[model samples]
Target: MFEYTIIDKSLENKIILITGAGAGIGKEAAITYAKLGATVILLGKTVSKLEAVYDEIIALGLAEPAIIPLDLKGATKQNYIDMSATIASQFGRLDGALLNASILGELTPFTQIHEQIFNDVMKVNVNAQYLLAQALIPTLQLAPNASLIFTSSGVGNQGRAYWGAYSISKFATEGMMQVIADEYENSTLRTNAINPGATNTGMRTSAYPAEDKDKLATATDIMPLYVYLMSDDSIAVNGKTIKAQ
Candidate 1:
C-alpha cells in the first residue's frame, strides 16, 4: 500500500492518541497528523517536550492538540482507565492510536542484563501497550472506523545478538498486535505493527553510536508509513508486520 496509497485529507476531525509524542518519530507523527487535520493527543513522559510539540501544532494553525504527561514504565491500569475516560469526556471518540513509546534498556547479552532494566523495558513496551489498548478499545469502537498501530523492530522478527530485553519486548508487541487484530477482525478497528528501521533519532544514535547518521533516514522520512496506516488507505491491512525503511 505504501507504493500507490494516495494521501488525502482523510483524517479531518479524527482524534488520535500517540505515545512518545515528545521527540523523534512520535513528534513528527503528531505534527503530521495534526497538519493532516487530526486532533492529536500527545502523550509522553516529558512535560516540556510534549508542550513544545503542542505549541508547534497550535502555531501551525492546525487542529489544536491535547497533552498528557505519562511515564509508561510507571503507568498503572488506572492510568490507562483514567486516560480513556478523559478522552471519552473530551473528544467523545478516539479514531486512532500509535503505540510508539519504548525504551532501549541495556543492549547487553541476556545474562549481563540487570533485572530492573528488563522489568522496565517490559513494563513500558509490552504491559503499557496492553493496558492502553484494552482501555481504548471501547473508545475506538465508538468511532465509525479506527486505526491502531504498534511499533515493531527488526529484532522483533528475528532476535538479534545483544539486543536483550528491548528485542523481547518488541517481539511481544508484535504478538500483541496480532492478537488484537484477530479479535477485531470482523469489527471496525484495524491493528498492525510497523518497523521504523534505521531512523536518525536519539534512540538510534544510542543503539549505533559508530554508525554514520547521514546514512540513515530521519523520522520524517518514514512518516508516509505512519500516515498510510492511520489514514483510510490501510483500513483493511491488519495483523501484519510492515517495514518503514
Candidate 2:
C-alpha cells in the first residue's frame, strides 16, 4: 500500500463524486470518503445499489450522500455537462472526483476480438471519461485543492495477452490522465490514476473465474492509496499512475 497515514476527518467539508459507487472499490471508496466527513455523490447505473450505500452512510452517521444514476455506455457529452452543471448549482464546487466505473469486455485473442464489444468497452472506459472530465474541470477548480482520480488496471501501462479492448481502453485512460494533469499542473486541480492491483471485484471474477479470490486483496484493503490521492496531502502529486496493493 502507498505510505500515507489515514487521518480522521481529513476530508471534512469536501464534496467528492465517485463513479461505480454501486460495488467493489468504488463502493468502498465512497463509504471511506464519507467517513472522513466528505459529502459523497454516489454515481452509478443502479439506483438500488446507490440507495443501499446511501442508507449505509446514513446509518453510520456519516454525511448524507447524494445519488446519480447514469449509464456511461449510452450517455452523451451533453449528459455530463448537465450533470456537472447540476453539481455546481447544488454544491457550488467539487473537491474531488473518482472516475471508477468501467466494463471488462470479453477477453479474447487479438485477432478474434468482436467489433461491438470493443466499441462498447471504449465507449464506457475512454470516451465517457473524456467527456466527464471536461465537464467537471470547472467545478473541480472551484476548490482550493482538488483531485481527479482515474481508475486503471495492471494491464493499463503494460499490455498482457488476451486482454483485448480492456487493455487498450486503460492505456487511453492513462493517457487521458496525463494530458489532464499536464494542463492543470499549475492550477489547484490535480489529476492522477490508480492501478488497483488484483483486487477481488466482480469484474475480476469474470476475467479470471478460476483464480483464487481468497488470496486477493479486498477493496477495503487498498483504500490507503485511494484516501491519500483524494486528500490534500497529494496536492503536489500529479500526472503519475500509483499502484494500490
Best lDDT among the predictions, by candidate number: 2
Residue 116, model 1, lDDT: 91
| Candidate 2 C-alpha lDDT tens digits along 52-121 | 9999999999989999999999998999999999999999999999999999999999999999999999
Among the numbered candidates, top TM-score falls to 2
lDDT of 1 by residue, 1-245 (tens): 23534355667899999999999999999998998889999999999999999999999888889999999988899999999999999999999999999999978987899999999999999999999999999999889989999999999989999998999999999999999999999999999999999899999999899999998998888888999899987888999999997
Global local distance difference test of model 2? 0.96
Task: Candidate 1: give its CA RMSD in angstroms.
Answer: 1.2
Clashing residue pairs in candidate 2 are none
RMSD in angstroms, all models? 1.2, 0.6
Model 1 stretches with alpha carbons more than 4 Å out: 1-8
